[model samples]
Target chain A: MTILVKIFGDLRKKIEGYNISDALPLNLQIESNGIDTIADILNKFSIEKEETYHLFVNGTYSGYNKKVKDGDRVGLFPKNMSLLYKWYFERNEDE
Target chain B: MAKRILRVDMTKLEANFENFPADFAALGGRALTSTIVAKEVDPLCHPLGASNKLVFAPGLVTGTKAPTSGRISVGGKSPLTGGIKEANAGTTFAQKLGRMRIAAIVVEGKHEEDDYYLLKVTNDGTEFIKANKWSNKGLYDVYKELYKEFGDKVSISGVGIAAEIRGAASGICFNDPEGLPSRYAGRGGLGAVMASKGLKFIVVDETGAPGVEILNEEAFNMGVKKLTNALTSHDVTKPGGALNSYGTCVLVNIINEAGGLPQRNFSSGQDDRSEKVSGEVKAEEIKKRGGVRPHFCSPGCVIQCSEVWTKPGGKDPVGVLEFESVWALGPNCSIYDLDVIGELNRTCNDLGLDTIEAGDLLGVAMEGGLLEFGDGKGALKMLNEIKNKTPTGRILANGTAFTAQAFGVTRVPVVKGQGLPAYDPRAIKGIGVTYATTPQGADHTAGYAIATEIMGVGGTADPKDTNKSDLSRNLQLATAAIDAAGYCLFIAFAILDIPEGLEGVVDTLNGVLGASLTVNDVAGYGQQIIDTERAFNKAAGFTEKDDRLPEFFLKEPLPPHNEVFNVSDEELDKVWGT
Candidate 1:
């Protein structure tokens, strides 16, 4: 499964060897095994769970446990880049 | 130098200083402004008529060394919403008002003639100067001329051509740190209210003025220390933080990713082209072009999210393209180019138009077949029409709902006659609740639910859940308190997360008032402010039906999510238990 991962804010610099796409969503295509959750993807990129604040799976705010599928679009934002923290965190708890 | 109220009677052409009412000692910022407006102004009075009074008040801790506390609230019966309105901006003008020990400046009665006057305030006294010479000019040039004539040490608040014409979209402009007419109380058409009084500008010179009095110096210092620590230490507000690095526009990509960034006049939710105008791009452009990032709108703001956007090589500066401004002027119109957005923002600043309302107006104009979507030049031309005061421009200047009606656009996104800000209600349901229920009309800051949850003021509710009433109501209450305290809303992010930071806010208020106030009393104080506003709005004939999103928001499904605003009317009414 090919999952397109996008990094934003200060999180772009935190990832090793990831080319920072200036002013654009930094897109990194990773071959995922479909079984990999967002947390697994974070681990794969050496990004700590705490470092990632707002996680979106295919444009909908998702949790770390949400499993990735083929052609899934995942976005990760750092804690400092937090915009809608309540909605993201509270919505996740409900799910 | 006790706190006093400067009452300018435009009808009599006289200004007088009155002793501040002891009953209002605990009130400041939005609380004081709203309270004064409610008490004095008749609710059913025509918003742009002689009966409407404009009140400006600085926050309680504004002039003191409270980090990021420089804010001023402008309150009046809104020409846009036909309801009580309080719009605030962060500027040195607020600090000047605070330092001068002026609790509020009430401009009452309308000038009988068409002639405009400037109110010059100093430590000594107040004087009125005939300001007919500066009427109908762009604020950028006018600000420069005003600073030159009045000297560089003064803080100015003025109206532009839009206000002169009594446009409902007009906003009161204030000087930024660089003395650019960039900062604005830019919502609810307060500028028209100010202009209705035949007032063009209020220039405050605070030289030799006593600073804000701290009644309990020790407690004040301790509170200041705690707040400063929280602001500096928080990852979001600290130096090199997300805001400092990218400014508020950082939310462009984030909101876009969440499929909530309104695109092409709310026709869709997300667009790939939104990246072209993202904060990251703007920040990089600012760095390369010798523009300023991490700049403070007012002095002593630790979370300096403001930036100066200039042309290549930094020729002309349009102070700080905020997140809402960028989104409203950029993607909402399907114009993604930063340069075009910059010019549009500059024009809005110059013309004294709220960018959010103006953008929404242009969107409806395009939808009504007045122009093609993404026609940046066409948008500029329409703004020029406003500057020229053409009939078409006049229609557009009355704000989103009026423009939408004029153009026969049915998919109007507004609540209570005011234009909705950047967030689409269909996607961000919580903010939608705020947009619908807030007395201010579609203001996101009125109940920023994010900070509310973190502050633990409102117990949590799932965004997907229908019961977001508690979330919105609690947030509004807490926000009212913060607005009254005069701290920047950005401070809420830190204070909510850090318990000591929230306590710090209460401590500063107690220190200033020399009254004992605990953290538990924050919501109660906020409730009093909200109750005053609610009473005023109720007296103005606002009903539960007024607290509603447009029918289109409930009927039309936003893209990506393909979700309508499904929160029932009962749930929405339950927001205020109406």
Candidate 2:
């Protein structure tokens, strides 16, 4: 099963000519043969599973190691000044 | 001869002028207020009680040749957050007062009766005037009436209807060039405490007064030129034009694009309706209406980031509606109409309230079905109640944390009863640290972690990387120090790119005070200020547990972003690592 990976913001700038609305069309070409676990998904971008990155799967929140299903729109995000969605996980360090 | 502090003992109906404290001479802004409050005011006292005090201290550069330094801070035990809050705003009147050699003014004690009064601080002396004619008025009207009597040139700080009602989200409004009462120490509800003291307004008249004297004119000139040049040359400060136009609202699309924009109250990162409320759209509206953008907050400001927005098609600006307020109220609450948002923003400004906290509560209310999502008119109605003192007004006026508690909503985005700003912890992990760590209670400016990711000002932190804990800590400390100086935080964008920008500010300070304060001194001062606030919070019954975010952050996963609040409390404990 191929999981959908969506890159955005400055990270998106690293790629060429990717529009925001159509991020999935660009993700369909990812081969599912070698990478299957959530850890493998992060490794593609020099990331680690416990690296404090906000993980997103589809339109709902998911847990780490949750099997990435076919066509899962996974968005990787960085921290921001305008923190709008942070209440979903409050167990983190207050700093 | 500098004007002395105007000290008032409201209970005794006595007032007097006191010389500046020897230790406070070198301190200004947060340095002065926090120092004075920590030493003099009892931190453990009830925020609204007589033991609590309000200290108004301008930035060190304020009234001096430094540009955009006319900002002032009002420090006290915040009724909203129940923490030490140092609220800030740009006031031209503040600069005029500072020009008269007044470093700060303190208001203490509770009034004997329910009668409200006004405080007038002029070059001659301080006096308490009868405020019977202006009771129950919003800050805009309050300033208008006072402005007429004060000859329109005086600096004024006052509370609004919400403040008079003693709500926690209440703030204090100061005068701007346009005199709309648009600027505020708009966080943590210090205004309510002032109102509790039976003081509605503080008028400072500096007409025909000499501005603050720079100890060394030559060094000051060099420092000012280099600083202004460094600021103007940076991309964010120079080319972005975001500051001059939409102010911080320009970050809406950028953060949304980064997949970090908290939508519908931490449920998702994208709201879709964000476009209709983007900074570009606001700029277009203001442009079409001949509205002014990038207006200075105070005199001598080189980086004019404040906007003078008019009612869409009108000539006079209704008020300032920034990025934080726009996101907090519009998408967070699922409301989209910019006009209605503007009305809500204006109402908040007049009420001397924190727009961020109020919007978060509105979101919670929407989740609980008290108000429907996307009902812009509904938000307008609820905000209208605040000024009128309805039950709903009382609930919403207290801030997001309290409102969420009252409504039994568990998915609250708050810290110490203060509403979280526009970032979601599940999406942007570093900003989560900032929201968690800031002494100011869930404020972004305390540590704007996004400056690295979205703004590209600092070393790019993978907003997705867990390593941001250390990164966020450094930024938070740096930001705390900057806030202490009362310098505009937007300067971070410039200093992040040009290190000299930071030097210019410090050099200017050294020249003024005849001190050899280095950049390290400034950074250390930030940590010191945080330490002071922590000591205050510790005395006020807060512990390591109060520092944590709301519990819902641990249970709920933000949609489209599967991130959890994974930073361990131990990791947080290590943030202020020695």
lDDT per residue (tens digit) for residues B14-103 in model 1: 999999999999999999999999999999999988889999999999999989999999999999999999999999999999999999
Question: Candidate 2: misplaced stretches above 4 Å?
Answer: A1-95, B449-465
DockQ of 1: 0.56
- The DockQ-based CAPRI class assigned to model 1 is medium
Model 1 residue runs over 4 Å out of place are: A15-21, A84-90, A93-95, B449-458, B461-466
TM match of model 1 to true structure:
0.98
Write one digit per residue (lDDT tens) for candidate 2, span B251-312: 67646644567878778877556767876577667767787776677767766766766775
Q: Model 2 Cα displacement at A35 (Å)?
A: 21
True contacts kept of 1: 0.60
Poorest lDDT segment (10 consecutive residues) of candidate 2 chain B = B449-458
